[model samples]
Target: MLVGDHLGRVETEALLEMGRLDGALMYCMGAPESIYAGLALRQTLIGALRQEGHAFTETRFQAWFAGLTTLSDDPSHKARPPRAVCEAILTELTHSAWPVLARTAASLISALLAPHDLQSPDAAVELHTVNAHARAMVDALGAAALTPLPALDALHHAVAQSTVFAAVERAEPALKLVRADMRSDPHQAPRWAVEMLYGSCLQSAGALHHPIPLVGLIRPDTAGDMEPGEARIIRAATLCEIMSTQLAMLAHASRQSKRAGALDTRSTSRAPDVLALLSGFGAMRSAQIERVLKATRLGVRGMVQLLLTAGEIEQTTVSGAHLYAVRTHPSDRLGITAPLEEAFSDDAMDEYDASMAQIDRLLNNAASLQR
Candidate 1:
C-alpha cells in the first residue's frame, strides 16, 4: 500500500523518478504540519502575549521556537528533534507566568487536531478527550506559580504521542531515507544521482563559486531507478573527478612551494607519487590505491604502513572496509581542500530554485490532507 496512491499517483511517480519518494513520504509524515503548527502557534502566542503587554524580541521568540521544535539543528536534515531540547522548551513555557501563551498553545493544538479525520465517532471522541486533557494541563500550568519540568515533559510527550500524530506518522513511507552521512554508501540511489549531478556541474562550470542546480537532475523521464553496479560506477567516476581536481591543486601548491624555496626539489623528487595520489584521492582501500597507481599490493601496503608510522596518513574503517587518507600537518605542503559547492549557470540556478519551490508546494499540499 503505497502512501502515494492516496496522495496522488502522478506526483508519487514523479517523486519516485527523482529518487525522492522516501523524502516525500517522510515529509508527508506530519513534519510540514508540525512545522506549520509550531510557527502558527508561536505567532498566535506572541500576539496574545503582546496584547497582554508582555515584552519579547523576535530573536527570543525564534530561539524559543527553535528549542521547542528542534529547528536549531540543520532544518534541511530529516532527523527527529532532540527530546532534551523539547523538554527544556516545555519547561520554560510552562513555568513562565504567561497564561496567554499557554492558552494560545493549547488552542492551536486543538485547532491542529480538528483537521485530522478519525476512524469513527468513537475515535473522534477519543481525540477530543485527548485535546481536553491537553487543555486542562495547560490551564493547570498557567494557574501554578511554577510548573515542574517533569509535568511539562509529560504534557509534551502526551501531545507528541497522541493518536492524531500517530495517524499522520503511519501515512508516511516506512523506508529509511538517505542522509548526508550515508553519501559514501554506493548502494543508495539518491547518493549516486547527487554525485553524478555534482560531477556534471563541476565539469560544466570549470570552477566552484556558482550554485549547483541539483533539482535539474530530478527529471521524471531521465531518473529511472539505478542498479547497484550503475551506482558503484557513478560513485567511482565522481571520486575520480574530485581526486583529479585535487591533484591539480596539489601540483599547483607544490610548484609554488618550490619557487618559494620552502620545499626541497631533491626531497620531492625522491618522494613516491603514491603520496600525492593518497593525499589527492582521500580515504581509499588498498586495492583502489593499487589500481589507481598501477602498483603492486605489497608495495602499496608497505608504503601505506610507512606513511601510517610517519603520521602522514591514517586509516579508518567505513562500511566494513579499511580506508586510508592523508593526515593534517602544520608543515604539509599541499593544502588541498574539497570544493564545497558546485558552480551553475544563473539560468540553471533559477530554474532549480523554481522546481524546488514547486516540489515543496506539492509535498505541503499532500501533508495537509487527512485521507
Candidate 2:
C-alpha cells in the first residue's frame, strides 16, 4: 500500500541505506493505497533502515515530515506514512536532535495550527487539546536532557508525556473520520474502528497525563478492526510532541495572570496605564475584573484590597459577590486634589520623606540667615 511498492526491494534498500530517508519516505508515501500494506512495509523499512545506523537525522526527518503534510492527499489516503512514523520521527528528534528539533517542531506545529484553528473550530479545538498534551511531554523531555546524565526514568517520563498528548490529538482526525462515516450510514457504522480509535486516544491520555491505565477506554465494538494498544500508543506519542511546545505558552499565560493581579493590588504596581482600565470599566466584580484584566483570583483580590485600604475604591456585597468601583472618576477629580492624603507609615518611607524635608528646611533657614 506504500506510494511506490512498485519499486523493487533493491531500490528500497539502496535509498534507505544511503541516508536517503526522504526518498524512502517518498516511495512509502506513493505506495499502493492500502493501509495494511503501507503500514507493514513502512515498519519493516524504517526498522531495517534505522538498524543499519541510517536513521533519519533530526533535521532531515523534520523537513521530510513537514513536506509530506503539505502533499495534501485525501484525508483517508491509506498510502501515506501512518501516524506511527510521525511518532517515531518525533522520538528520534527528542533523543538525537535535542533542543533544535524540539524547538523547531514546537514552533512549526503551533504556527501551522494557529490559522487552521481560527478558521475552523472543530479542527482547532482538537488540535489545541493535542498541542497542550504534546507540549507538556516535550518540555518534560527537554527538562530531562539538562540532567547531569540522561537517565531512563527521565526519558520515560518525557516519552510518556509525548505519547499521551499525541494520542489525544491524533484522535481528533480519527474522530472526525468516524463521525463522517456514522452520519453517512448509521446502520453500516464502522463501529469497532471508531470505538477503538477513541478508546486508544483515551487510554494514552490516561497513561501519559493521569494515573489511569487508559486500556479501559479501548472501544471493543468498531468494525474498523483497529488494534487498540498499538494504535493508542502511536496516537498518544504524536499528541505529546505537539503539546510539548505549547506548555511554554501555558506557563506564559499564568505569569501574565499573576502580573495582572499584582497591578490590581496597587495601581502603581502596573506597568501599563491603570487609569485606562478603570475608565473602561466603572464597576466590576472580582471575577469579571480578573477576566477583563487577565489576572488570577488572588491577584484581583489583592488589588481590590489595596484600593479599599487607600479609599480609592469601595467594596460592597452585591448578590453575595464582592464588587469594586472607583470612588471618584479620574476625569472628574482631574481639577481637584483630595483634601486628605494618607501618608506612608512605613519606617523606610518616613526616613525618605524626613530626609527630603530636612534638606528643604535647611535651604530655607540658610536663606533667612543670609537675609
Model 2 alpha-carbon drift over 4 Å, by segment = 1-70, 77-119, 141-153, 157-163, 166-371
lDDT of candidate 2 over 1-371, digit per residue (tens): 43223222223232222222111112221111121121222233233223222335422322233332221222222222223323333332233222322432232222121012122444334334543554444344444344211221233333334333212212234355466444431111111111112212222322111111111122222113455334334333333322332222222222222333444343445322222233222344555455545677786676667666766666655336555555654423323322111112255345545554654575457446755
Please give each candidate's TM-score.
0.24, 0.19
Compose the digit string of candidate 1's lDDT tens values, residues 1-371: 54334324433333322322112211221222222223323433443333223345643333333222222222322211222222222333332232432432343232221112123354334434433453454454334433222222232333334433211221333445955455431111111112112322332222222111121221112122555334333333333333443333423334322322332234533124444544432345666556555667887787777667766667766435566765655544435532211222355445545655776776668657836
| Residue 260 shift from truth in candidate 2, angstroms | 50
The Cα local distance difference test for each model comes to 0.35, 0.32
Candidate 1: where is the Cα deviation over 4 Å?
1-195, 198-272, 315-323, 330-371
CA RMSD of all predictions: 26.3, 27.0
